[model samples]
Target: MIWNEHIECMDREQIEKLQSQRLCEMVERVYYNVPFYRKKMQVLGLEIGDIKGIEDLHKLPFTTKDDLRENYPFGMFAVPMSQVVRVHASSGTTGLPTVVGYTRNDLSNWSEIVARALYGAGVSKEDRIQNSYGYGLFTGGLGLHGGAEKVGATILPLSGGNTRKQIQSLVDFEPTAISCTPSYLLYLAETLKEEELLDKIKLRVAILGAEPWTENMRKEIEKQLNIKAIDIYGLSEIMGPGVSFECINQCGSHIAEDHFIPEIIDPKTLKPLPRGSEGELVFTTITKEALPLFRYRTKDLSSLIYETCECGRTSVRMTKITGRTDDMLIIRGVNVFPSQIESALLEIGETQPHYMIYVDRVNNLDTLEVWVEVDEKFFSDEIKQLEALTRKITKQIVNIIGISVKVKLVEPKTILRSEGKAKRVVDRRHI
Candidate 1:
């Protein structure tokens, strides 16, 4: 799988024809191998031949998280359990995790896609990659590790946590690149600063993903660590972290068009949205054997572009996810994302980076509050000054989120620091 030479550099017409051919085969394979899909097809009165190509893809029923949950462990799997070499699961905060399986060929295919992403980002066989993404049920660690190895990269498989150990590995290994969540990398940068080992380690690129991050955050990390921070995007349901990645251009992440077909649709109506339109990302796995999902609604909000990228790849480009449709919060009829609050908080230079959002219902009305940690160096004993600082943050939040929020300024380290997905929202009303 030398990166599928013809597919990578194909013209628009050629790519479309290849995708159409692959889609028809995948749909037929799913109908025969997976009972869940067969039942869905039966109810819809659809047959294998009906879906002759990509155009018929829109006719197929969309798969969702509920479908995966309904099937539980193996009902949706296209291959037998004995053939499955690995299984990865979702975080499962809501209920039972959505599980995904992979055969040996599937794993190899995944590695190839991931390698393409790495190669596009300038990672070559000679480089050493330090992987800080967690290993296990989560796909980040192993997904990236396998790809780095496929590219002949010497990998330092240092999973997340243990800040001291992570920094030690960085110094000892002196890897040329690193992969992990953006927030965790920021935390690592802070730790490295405290240890005064920033200059000793050598890293040119940092592949960050798994959560939504902004260009502002990217600039901050780049400045702190002195590395070119590149954005890599993927979901566990799709194929881990190599579904798409930003090439050298840094404009947007290029989706692996040949393997996973990308489509944008309105989350509410499920109607197809036009290209370059921001909507929920839906994917149809074209060549996947173990689990070929047809039109799986990812709920991730992004836009799609199908033009030649500056990086010279014909693969489609997807904008960085601003926020997930499911994660949106309704506060007094105003829709908001935690990232909006974070962006507002960052603008206020007075407060520290540590902050938490709280929502409560009082007399059937929602109330918003933010707890912002104050740096010890900027701490003042006067209550009036602290109140003034809080007022400034409150105004900033109001301007950004269009909702007035009470800001509480506390001492340093008052709020906990999370290395994984940051717990920014506390909805007492939901409880």
Candidate 2:
């Protein structure tokens, strides 16, 4: 299922050589076309000719989201509006949205990379895919849609929400694959079970991304939906959902190094870490035509692996993202990630996957409370049983995260379900 085997499985030497050439060209393109990048390079005492290859990538100045916002619309674009054919942007909760543009060639290349991602996740023309990601401004829908088209798969463009229609399409269309956020997939599973349509559909593969999910969550999704759950990694700031993807082996997600060069660096020191060392992930777009970025800091924490995968793709792979540095919750001076809590809850195997973390300040001290859902059958048990379960959960979380948390057990379907990325935390301390 490896698309573009020649590039995906290229030798390390060939890959680096091709990357070096593209990197040099990208540097030159941005230097003359984008003033922001040119100024950043000049400030760092760099010229277009100075960047000869990917080896000198570390010397280039890193681009941040603030830089994009400071420039506002189209300032980061390397090509003029006449040559740009499409534009995609991140969902900016505050201030202006980060803007990105694409040339005709850029969109075409985007399709191919997304196709490679879908192929890596075992999608093909024979499969009917139900894409549940949203359309319009959101990159997830169009990104997955283009890739599905490139793979020649039958597409049911049922963008996110409307659980009833999604289930109806699943039963009626009988799609063999699906794409959506992992949490939304779980929500869909719940609805399908309620409607008794889980067995009517024929889904064998799920291309899930948009947020960090743990292995336990993957297993829960697979077990509930009766499908192979594969993780796809990407960002609108970089490329949508096709940056990298896991092969059937599921060892790690193989990065498309021939296009996007990835580097893991210590977030504190801003120094590149050796492979397998966890740090902030950074990417440089060497093939993008409309908007070329130099060492864009993704702020995601993950390590890389260069060992050729069992899938036979020589493209270097990244481990599952632990969490975003911005998303880390510091409670009582101890750092914790929502994914870690989800993993612990799933490993305990005593409650449903639906849960939420509440962080607040009590008497000037940070407090953490975890609300978990239990099956109705168990929830209706004697008071002592629920109390024991609560104690067990509190103990388990403290043991794993090194922070004492008040555990609240609730009935099934109490917490709101999300058809997109699940909102896992309610931090009122800032408010």
Candidate 2's displacement at residue 53, Å, is: 1.2
Tens digit of per-residue lDDT, candidate 1, span 1-431: 23556667788888889999999888888888888889889999999999887777788999987788788877889988899899998633233567998989889988988898788777888889999988888788999988999999899999876778888988998999999877678777878888888999999899888766778878889999898898888877788889998876789898888889999999989999888899999999998877789999888889988888765678889988876777556554344667777777778776666888888766434688888888876677898887787788898877777657888877677687789988888877542
Top lDDT hit? 2
Q: What is the C-alpha lDDT of each candidate?
A: 0.82, 0.84
Q: TM-scores of all models? A: 0.77, 0.78
Question: Per-residue CA lDDT of candidate 2, range 29-69, in tens?
Answer: 88898988888888888988888888899999998877888
Model 1 stretches astray by more than 4 angstroms: 1-5, 328-431
Instruction: Indicate the residue-level lDDT of 242 in model 1.
Output: 90
